[model samples]
Target: MATLSNCFQPLKFSPKRHRFNSTSLFTRRCSVSATINQSKLDILLDSVKWDDKGLAVAIAQHVDTGAVLMQGFANRDALASTISSKKATFYSRSRSKLWTKGETSMNYINICDVFLDCDKDSILYLGKPDGPSCHTGSETCYYTSVFDSLHSSQAEGSKLAMTTLQSLEATILQRKAEISESSTAKPSWTRRLLLDNKLLCSKIREEADELCRTLEDSEEAPQTASEMADVLYHAMVLLSVRGVTMEEVLTVLRKRFSRSGIEEKRSRKLEGS
Candidate 1:
């Protein structure tokens, strides 16, 4: 009898035939690739506490932002294929085939690492998505909240609700894009800041001073938080104007986390020297 690992060979499903009704099945290429030890992978797959259907919950999360992108089910083959391909692959229970996340839309999640939960029943695919993960063109799939879905006045709940920093960065980018396209449209505060360099610099200086004062004057927690928000907003506006992404900033911060602040500053100084 074939072992459980031998039973689930990763099926190369054609997205054209599976996702859409088309005559020709087009081949797509992914940028990421990897290889895993078969023996080790088989042993790990056998250890997983899969449900009766031989599937476990797999969640894809943004590597930089830690935002949950999408959730699906995966079997042994899906997991193995994900490791080898370096792209998130799921077992479509309905289609009964391997479904790579971005085969159709080209919004593939390029996985950096795979992690197993404490219970060994769930898997996490830590990755960076190339584009919007949701079918509705939102950044991530978990944008809608249960409370907002039921209580909001709008028929459809907000699909753009994300973490505060991600949301603010997106808003700033949107303002910049809108300002670029529509010259006559009324500008928002963010737009005005993008347009006027002197005003933006002044605002940044003002917010930074206020934020410092909050600590110096022993202001309330709320006041300090408010001042910090203003400073972050202005700084992010400057970043956007310079065409620098939040991801780049976050990547630098993440790198610095492995070292002391003094060490990081010293390295920067050395580079400048």
Candidate 2:
């Protein structure tokens, strides 16, 4: 009778309560990040010297190839939006509104960073283009040069637009692509090298030896440069075959630049371990 009375007593339960909602936490973190970004944008915008029309000349340049892609005018909103979104934006004089590049064409000029000239009147948008940056399907808008057009002695639109190493790598990649399409086409030296891994490696070794010998033999500067160029070209071909980019190699080198050679080697060994 006593146990029955105790059992019949009111039953109480306690449920654990969560202190935070996942969705709300995420929203709060996003809000904080947005606030910090806004503060930075505000500081940057205040530094630019906007003209009477509230516009500044903005020039877009290729981040990789160092080509001047295009030029436009950007108002405060356009500049702010560009920094926020990391897309090249401009204030169209005719449209009288903000227009982002590639909004309609889908060939975006992705901004990597922005620079202000000494005068602070002009802005440089260092970026990479998805495709041809010009409306006429040209790689860059400033393709035609008055000096080059008038002078016949100078090579017209030289292939030197891209840096030597990058240009060589590009050519190697192009040769790789063309090999499959045009099997019957005349086999180039690069094509032969790509087809034969052994030959490519052998050439790289041979060129490297020659490069070293230039110093050993006390060769002239031109001879050393020639040998070094051969070594670089062959090494770049090997890089292309491995599907590695020059930028990737440069990034690793850049990381090592800040550290001593011995320290860098030790770090690599530790990483390997």
Candidate 3:
């Protein structure tokens, strides 16, 4: 099992200065060899710093799909337990107990690389999750992320949904290729879209406008999740047809999130105005 935290960030910490009175502190002398061995077990990393509450935050990631599982707080024992079991187990600060991740749903997040912060008080466990890490029945604690593939870990529980999405994405690609090949012999709608840039762009624009124009109606009938899925799928095809990868779209979104409100709006306005 591998962890799939695709992003990384540098950490900075500022701690208050303190003076240690060595004279008042008792020093226990031990054999040089024994001391060295103890040092190994007692080692702390700046990466895994314990927080003020003596708890460390652990983020779990999926390996192949690179989906994030869930975040938890871990005491030493919980960390050790996860390492020992090769599965996620955390200390419940509010419950005052241990929480075995996926215990209820059997969706275990297997650890791969464990990154400690500069202070060695926290950890980042990168790996693939077996099933939904969140108990709320969503793929992630986050309700929405444009990178739907990043929801694989959580969607593992919904075998049907996961399979359908995967198949749909693949099918769309294959269908486009097939349509392109057949279009050379017979100018079909799909072939025309591939050959005529203007037509393709017009169709994509139409789909986008239609998607934006339709609001989910709860009056006569509420919109089913499938309807939204269709809109999103069409949008994805529009991107694919334009030679844009999903990763690129997500990168733009990340930049948008990182920007301040004014900066963000200004950038968008610059593109338009």
Candidate 4:
């Protein structure tokens, strides 16, 4: 049996805290303390009963979103690398060697934590992906649904089955690529916006004003939501044009999570001054 203390140590505080002013305590990157017992790693590895081919089932899950990114198998070395490097690594059964996720695609997964199932036969890796987890360019490996009766209903609900921002970002990237590849590619509103920065900025302003109007009509929740979506979409377009990712924006938000809104504002003011 492996204990948390034996496996890893708590994160150390940085001497320069201002560098992490926007980041939350929980979001702070931690180092695997030297105190971690080598015997503990051996104990964990020994607990797993690998298949005849010397592999254990490993599932990669999104740390924040709780989405299952992908599944693979891990040999002893792969598993050890994953733990030590804090990156997802698995054994490629076909290649008969260890493979690190995102090595070729640049869509690496940063592992936050790891877990073992009750049966101790399977491993779960919780991580944040740098880009699309699937080779097909989808956010997750399980994008297609074979039998999803609730899909239609879920689409109408407040919470979407898939992340709207991620989908929109992927679409924006595709449109940008298409436009770059061929000028004659059917002109899309998004493509046009991406090409003309001034027009995109204007559209964002227009959408933001419309969203503000919708907010005045508190009773019209659906209208407000629609207007807000338009604002978000345009904002995303601007971000895409600037070669900024949604993840980068989310990282800023994550950093501010631990601070009060007023404190954050004051800090910004101080910094500007």
Cα lDDT of model 4 by residue, 50-126, tens digit: 88887889999876556688999998888888888878999998989999999999778887678888987888988
Estimated TM-score per prediction? 0.66, 0.60, 0.41, 0.56
What ranking of all candidate models by lDDT puts the best one first? 1, 4, 2, 3
In order, candidate lDDTs are 0.74, 0.70, 0.53, 0.71
Summarize candidate 2's per-residue lDDT along 1-273 as a digit string, tens digits. 001111111111111122322222122211122333677778888888999999999999866567688999999999988877778999999989999988988767877678999988899998766666778666667655455557756635432234555556666777787898887866577777888999989998888888899899999999888887777777887888998777556534544555589987898899999
- Backbone clashes in each candidate structure, one number apiece? 0, 0, 22, 2
Better of 1 and 4 by TM-score: 1
**Worst 10 contiguous positions by lDDT, candidate 3:** 26-35
lDDT of 1 by residue, 4-97 (tens): 1211221211111122211111112223343567898899999889999999999999777777889999999999888888889999999999
Cα error, residue 272 of model 3, in Å, equals 58
**Candidate 1, residue 207: lDDT:** 84
Ranking by TM-score: 1, 2, 4, 3
Query: What lDDT score goes with residue 11 in model 2?
Result: 14
How far is 174's C-alpha from truth in model 3 (Å)? 13
Q: Say which candidate scores most in lDDT.
A: 1
